[model samples]
Target: MADTTGPISTLPGAHHSVPAGVMCDDHPDRPATHRVQGETDSFGCELIDMCDECHGEWKAYRDTPQGGVCDWCGKHADKLRPRRDYEEGMYGRVYDVCVPCITRANQEAEEELERSGWYD
Candidate 1:
């Protein structure tokens, strides 16, 4: 039988237990909301964004820079290729691939299309 559980979210790693404070930017007492960011304020101690992950100020910290260490998903790894491709689509700009995901995806697609009677 399939396990019926609560809804799964893309955003994992939720630590909402703020210590007794509004949170100083560089408080050693504060735990960083972004585990993978390795972020720090002007000071040496870790910085706490409104959303430590996204830096949404009102909700969390707002409009954070992309390419920050994404603690949310493991989409990125150490071997990320340097170049990327962009394309115009029905929904605006879309990523064709980032070289690596492209290579893997292309190979998979080719094999899928090559199945018996697929091209026939």
Candidate 2:
């Protein structure tokens, strides 16, 4: 299996994109500033356009008492890294997730694919 233990930016694959002038699906009142990427979807991907306040709240919510942490695990880290590829898709970018979490997520994704007979 390919290395699933690297930053999301290091992983090669397509990301999500939405239409322009789209409002935050979560908050229709606010203009979408962040494109939140979720699992891969059939009709494009599960992309969400989030407002700045929502995005900031999301980051704060994902953070630990010590400092910012991985998007997956809540473990505290000195610094978080962004997935550049996913980030550059539209405007909103991938949250600063940690390497370990990225690796684990990739591993889980690979395992899921294997279970689903994606390789077979």
Candidate 3:
């Protein structure tokens, strides 16, 4: 007979399966399966691996005006819309922006294009 009731025997490996704990910064009682990394007023923009429940909570917070804040200017309101804008040279990389910031960026892009004679 072998002594199997040991820490080494219970270690996560080919013979043993260890369950990963909840990695969500907000919810610690659920299993984390989604990775959220971006700028947030409440969370201060960082990489957070969260569970589905926490992710939903985050989305709700991001979509609501009172819960969501502008990532660019740190402005908080209930009317600010969430915008996903792509960055230059960052393929498929989209980040959150406020309505005002997106509007400003669009205006700037239009002005730049006009100045470059790209529209003409």
TM-score, cand. 2: 0.36
In model 2, the worst 10-residue window by lDDT is 1-10
After aligning candidate 1 to the native by TM-score, how far in Å is the CA of 1 from where it should be? Answer: 58
TM-score of each: 0.24, 0.36, 0.44
Q: For residue 107, give model 1's deviation from the true position in Å.
A: 1.0
**lDDT tens digits, residue span 63-86, model 2:** 644347666577887766554333
lDDT of each: 0.33, 0.55, 0.51
Evaluated at residue 115, the lDDT of candidate 1 is 82
* Model 2, C-alpha of 101: deviation from truth (Å): 9.7
Q: Candidate 2: which stretches are off by over 4 Å?
A: 1-18, 41-44, 65-120
Alpha-carbon shift of residue 27 in model 2 (angstroms) = 1.5
lDDT of 3 by residue, 28-82 (tens): 6655666554433322233456667866787887665544676767876446543
In model 3, where is the ten-residue run with the lowest total lDDT? 6-15
Alpha carbon lDDT at 12, candidate 1: 21
Model 1: per-residue lDDT, tens digit, 1-120?
A: 001112222112232333343433444454344322122122222223332523343233223323422222336543332222223222222221244566765677677778855977
Model 3 stretches with alpha carbons more than 4 Å out? 1-22, 26-29, 38-45, 67-78, 81-101
Q: How close is candidate 3 to the true structure, as a TM-score?
A: 0.44
Higher-lDDT candidate of 1 and 2 = 2
